[model samples]
Target: MNRIPYANAVGAIMYTMTCTRPDVAYALGVTSRYQADPGEEHWKVVKTILKYLRRTKDQFLIYGDSDLKIEGYTDASFASDKDDSKSISGYVFTLNGGAVSSKSSKQATVADSVTEAEYIAASEAAKEAVWMKKFISELSVVPSIEESVPLLCDNTGAIAQAKEARSHQKSKHGLRRYHLIRALLNVETSEFKRLMERKMQQIHSLKHLVSKSLHETLDLGNINSIPNTDDYLWTHGAISDETLSLERTVCNDSTYMRLTVRGRRSQGCDYVFSRVSDEIGADVEHDDLLLPKCLSSSSAQFRPLGLHGKIHAAIARRANIGDPCLPERIFTYLNRPDVQKALHANTTHLPYLWHSCSGPLQYQQDNLDLNIIPLVLDILKEGIPILLFSGDQDSLIPLTQTRTIANILAKDAKLLTMDKYGPWYDGKQVGGWSQSFGEERDGKNVTSLTYATVRGAAHEVPFSSPSQALTLFLSFLKGSALPRPHA
Candidate 1:
């Protein structure tokens, strides 16, 4: 009777057979042998199998794009079954090649020696190999099987027996039966030679062909054939509409109009210039007037401000127009108490500020800062390459922290330090460092960290050096190598 539970178990066995559990093929086959006969023990064993599947559910075989080369393995456990006194035979076959076929089952007959049992397994595997060769040939588009498929047997004796036909005695009945493989091998030698020649031809042909498909058979035409004109129209049309709406909104907004009027009024004001001059004059006098009598005791009772005033007045007369109103606005903005408070508030939230102040709340916040280490680790596990770049002059996240993070992420990663070059140059030598990690181990993961000190650059490196900033940003997006600044 075919039960739903039995059907589910069979479905699971087929799923595993298709995926990475070629090792379990023999076990599934053995258990399925007892499938027709109902038993409580069999159900218990199936449940255990399901539990094993659950534990290894995430693991899967990774098939890379490469030439299909037939490889195989054969193994047998000595007297594994207590009831039959027979060894379990198992073999796996791979092609391009990943494990494409496998089987595991108790031997049909009991073997006297471990060597005998392994020879039997090898024979079984060879039979499958013959069938596989025929199946591959039948496919219309399959690549030619030009090379001698390697049959890997861990037992040295089995390998010797397979290679040496004279080693088997005529009295050895099981060994005699399996000697058919040696006969088949003799017949297939010419075919194997032809396969080798075909492989070389394929390799040479692939070298000149740039259009060869790469990685899991990507639908390149499906993606590339999508008209670029459609994308351009969709993106540019939306952007144009948004731009028009933004302009209309800005022109109609009362606040924007008021700001524009205020900006013009301030720029046109002669009184603003006069006020700045008066303020500068007052500042000079106040400093001179506040000077301690003891420090000025040795000098004459001459007013320094009065002398400076004459010099400034001469300069003002020469110019005829007072200082710009922009300077007065800048001073007014800087002196505003609300602006000063906001600046202080923003600065206080910085990690360095927290460290200096020893603020518990800020320290906790810094501890919980979004470190990219976990994300990098996850990406590496999924076999995705990651690149990290940082500037030495970056006070926010220093080069030291970046290096520490990279080292913690993966040791196999390639780390590179590059000198700043190209547009990032400021007439002086400046460059950045980079670190990378992955299977390619190529310079692709190489990240360049560059730093520049403007003749008088402060914390905001980009703001101080816009040209260098633009060069760095362009290099990052385009994956272009930065030109090195000469020392």
Candidate 2:
């Protein structure tokens, strides 16, 4: 009946999750979500975990005297939480095949793709590994080992992102802290020198390919002017087939200058161009952006009939977008005293009424050009297995883009296609189209990359197609190919 003890019990179990038992971490995380308002279902789940832990209390780690090399393993459950939509990340470090340290935590930010979630998880594990290495160096002989601590991750795309230096647009939305692992991979330990050398060689080769492609595809031009400080007018002359020369001319004051350029012609008249100033003290001009004034001005200069009435109607209609009834219903529900009490929310009354998304949040678009192709190539070179999947219903990042990206990475990595493009299956029914790529080593085809689509699924595959997603996940974990149809 009481909710206070639920928080305390969850907190007590969380200590074990953080310190020793990684197996219980996911369950604890799930139960902790309902801590503020524990329902009967939540309490039952917590009780189940407590019963399981009681039965396993006799278990203890017995480290062997030999084989003390440090190794890390990481995995992530993407968008496991329906409420917050956050991925769950779990990692463990082992000494002599026994876990020395472990962690399970919800990802700090939402990941747009499975690769992003796995990459963030690996980065978190890398941070812990770095700390563990430093700690072991003081306590034991791990410092003398000449190999980089192997961090095993299931996703190849994430592994590639970590090894590559380029920022990809797909991964640019990832938080900056996740990219710190790339820097750590290069600098924290000298054991990764081989990887560094391979990365540099790949970079040099990539530069050559890019330069060659540009030269072959584009018209080249040479600069015609050099800078002269004494000259009042600065010019770059004309470059290539450009009609106008870029010139910067000084104004009456030395600190101020203006840049003039051509504008598109309309009805045999050249439109006025906006001028840019070079100095901080220059006064900037503002365009006529007021709605009524601009509408009147546009009507004066070649306008269509019914334009004003159509514009008014459009403006009035635009205000009522989205589910009209949903907002009012949500507002009514949140204002209820019982609901607020149950949620433990609205403790402090503010001047303004409660709103859904009124938090002061600003996003810095830092990684706009981050391309993860090179990173994928780096992971392929390391002979790690990677699986890339997309939901067919996801138009935001379509299956076409994912498949094309995989093909490009395969080409860059020089991986031979193991199977031609064809339909893969789940329980005798068509799951989606797929292809495999990798190399043959020691009489076995070592698959480095696999690409598949989940038919009828949306952005979050598991949410829409749980059974199919489960089948695909099991295949990935088993290190076996996706099921093929019978002949």
Candidate 3:
């Protein structure tokens, strides 16, 4: 084969490999190596790639219409080239759900072991990640924020090296440029208020203002837990110290009854009205949760004030315990057509039943690793803030557990305590206790991460302590500290 034709074919394939077909990158890399000497083997490999591309000609890269976010994966084949004894580094970056950038090439230097090869690959990927982050930040269509681009590697050693500041003798031979990742990320700040505004925005995106906020807010439990009453069993434990303290100064049945009735009624009305409105608008838009929303909304009305109220009272009277079967009854009642019509619900005629939760609610135990350390680091590297809050009265996932998690995250992220854990006020009363994390000095504060517990709240913070929850929510949205009492 003529050298010119081989080089031309390789160049064309290289263009496609660099742009869209990342799957062919390794093959292109191998084939391009012998461009100086045209051989039957090199030509055979080139022809194979062309054949593969022809067979899969209909395939094209699909970048979906989703939010702009970058994530990357990197790997390496150790000393794969027998001729040169060099490893192959491969990396591909995704924007939302589709690939936007990729590379596959032989290492510039030979690596002695698999670990080193993988580390080099991850370093290369991190460089690309940083570049992509900068590019995405510049785009008018995307948010102008430095969000950490996650560079994933299965090699533990590479992750360790990326996080470590000090150089080890073993990795001394590794190029200094590859250590840029470590320099790019550091979460330390002396005071809560010293965190950069960009960091605050990142935190804001994590919780309240981003597209994934709704999904994050609604994940109530995993497969290990069941629904409704069973999940709230912890609330019935010996009243918490927080609840006991409130009992002396705030116990009043009339006040309690009035609040419960009002809250439930307001929630019920919203639920039903929303369902009715959703039904009316079903022709224009569709959602999987519409039927479930209608059922839950209708069920709320019956909980403390409607048909099931009597049944609950009777059950409480007979068993000398709170009603647990209300959900079962409510589910049955909402399935009735008359009840659906009364609520102006499910006009779309959904194929599924109107249950509060959908099936496959079960999650594997193996999937329950809820560690957020890496995730926190990823967002913090992007200059985002993180806020964690708990309802004071929630026993199931109590304040202690939440507080501990926040403290560990802060320590791991190297965040300084902006404010020691202390009471925050809502209307001259202690609404909750909170702690702030950031960089602070000379009384100037730049807060990054904040954690709070809503006083007198249940597992469902808003439902149990609406006023306090609102206060916390608003403060978070404003990226401000929870209010302090006048000294």
> Per-residue lDDT for 313-356 in model 2, tens only?
11211122222123234555787878887898777855566654
Instruction: Determine which window of 10 residues in candidate 1 has minimal summed lDDT.
Output: 218-227
Better of 1 and 2 by lDDT: 2
Error of 1 at 418 (Å): 50
TM-score of decoy 3? 0.37
User: lDDT of candidate 3?
Assistant: 0.57
> Relative to the unseen true structure, what is the Cα RMSD of model 2?
31.2
Runs of candidate 3 exceeding 4 Å displacement: 2-4, 170-172, 187-487
| Residue 307, candidate 3: C-alpha displacement in angstroms | 38
TM-score of each: 0.36, 0.36, 0.37
The TM-score, computed over Cα atoms with residue i paired to residue i, of candidate 1 is 0.36
Q: Which tens-of-lDDT digit does each residue in 98-141 have in candidate 3? A: 57777767888788778778777777777776677666667756
* Predicted candidate 1 versus true structure: per-residue lDDT over 441-461, tens digit per residue: 363444332222222221233
* lDDT at residue 229 of model 2 (Cα atoms): 16
